[model samples]
Target: MRSEMPYANISGTAVAIPVTGGSLAALVRLPTQLPAPTVICCHGLLSSKDSSKFAAIVEDLCQAGFATVRFDFSGCGESRSASEASLLGTRLRDLLRVMAFVQEQDWNNGQLGLMGCSLGGYLALLGAADSSSVGVKALVCWATPFDLAGIRTALESGNLPHAMATASRQLGEPQDLAGLPPLSRVLVVHGQQDATVGWRAAIEIYRRMADPKELLLFEEADHRFVDPACRNMAIQASTDWFRKHLAGSP
Candidate 1:
């Protein structure tokens, strides 16, 4: 691990995790406190661990005494591209691997939280629902789609990545959030004006989930939360949610 001090009270480490074909590039940031609660962040379909929104949230999380892990899901950012035929499955495995890696690290306190954006959010849900993710205490999904069907047009038109388009064909039917097992504490944030994925997806996700859930809709924000103010609000809310749920984990 390559370590550097990003802040007076926080340190950042760059690490490469081995996967099927190649290693996934990741950055692990921790506060001065040892054995801190950790939050693993997943980027969007076309985004990376270095996303401004993700960076902001990671900084906030670290300042709040939470360690954060940000990594690229194969084919995006610095991670090697995965096979087009197994893009979705490969990404899921990647997340599970990262989760396991974090759990084994001495800095982790056995308490875990997950945060994901867009497609990453969907993957986060899948990861949290898996039997192996029993240690996950909370989740924050931003601009997450309840179903993948809505993006078929974008996938087909080449607006999205070819790997996802190909994987969608193999998967056949789109999976919905309702199919996921009962989730832990969840926070669903969306923008009412989101053109990519409608706001109703957020409602569906919120409704399908049990208690300890919340939905935040920004009237002027788009799918990416492009507005500076809206993005900051979303980050603050997510950081606060993780703080509440993970910090209180028993």
Candidate 2:
């Protein structure tokens, strides 16, 4: 028999967050306590809040006493807008709006945290790195790409905005790194055998961040952590990191 442990009370509500083009379809999970710390979950390219990996992680976070919000980027899930493709800046703006929306809720303490996977991870790091005013206190990134050039090359063959195509060339181009605010604490996780994006990107991100950071490389896992054991480890690590950093903060 497995050992039993008490989990924090959790509840979820479906809500639409207003954005420029349309409302973002999102699910907000709360830990039954008011003014609690919250973590916004960002999904990878072509993924949404309902993605299996994200859903599992969100559940773990909620049980660990953190409020979690997961939403679909424009054009991806139930959101109303339809962009031919998601731009880096657009994703950043959406996250900022989510931050604003969360702040309005009386139940939130305004102590924010972010967790992202793959492309989402890249956005999380970018958003938190420059988030002096947004109040992002901690970040968790899994298999994030450090550069946008590769993404552009892979997706640009399809329909994409001219400006977005041009912008991708500039993002993650070293100059972008200069503008990113220093992060207080960070956790970077990557699969050792990831084929989509190399584990080296994790190292690059670690190099860019300040102290009080950690990196975990899992062997025998792919980009999505296809293996159940790897996935479990990833969820546990992410939940623990957020708990350690986000606890006791108003």
State each model's CA lDDT, in order: 0.82, 0.77
Model 2 misplacement above 4 A: 1-11, 82-86, 131-133, 159-179
Candidate 2 residue 244 C-alpha distance from true site, Å = 0.8
Q: Across residues 1-250, which tens digit of lDDT does each residue of candidate 1 receive?
A: 4233343334467788877777889999988888889999999877899988888889988989999999988777778744445446677888998998888788888999999999889899888888865578999999998887755555556666534624544433335677777685999999999998899999888887777888899999999998999999998999899888888878
lDDT of 2 by residue, 65-174 (tens): 78888998765778774332246656777788887787777667878899999988887877776534487888999988877666666555554433332333333233
TM-scores of the candidates are 0.89, 0.85
Please name the candidate that would achieve the greatest lDDT relative to the true structure. Answer: 1
Candidate 2 local distance difference test against the native: 0.77
Clashes counted in candidate 1 amount to 0
Off by over 4 Å in 1: 1-11, 81-84, 153-174
Model 1: lDDT equals 0.82
Q: Which pairs of residues collide in candidate 2?
A: 35-107, 129-181
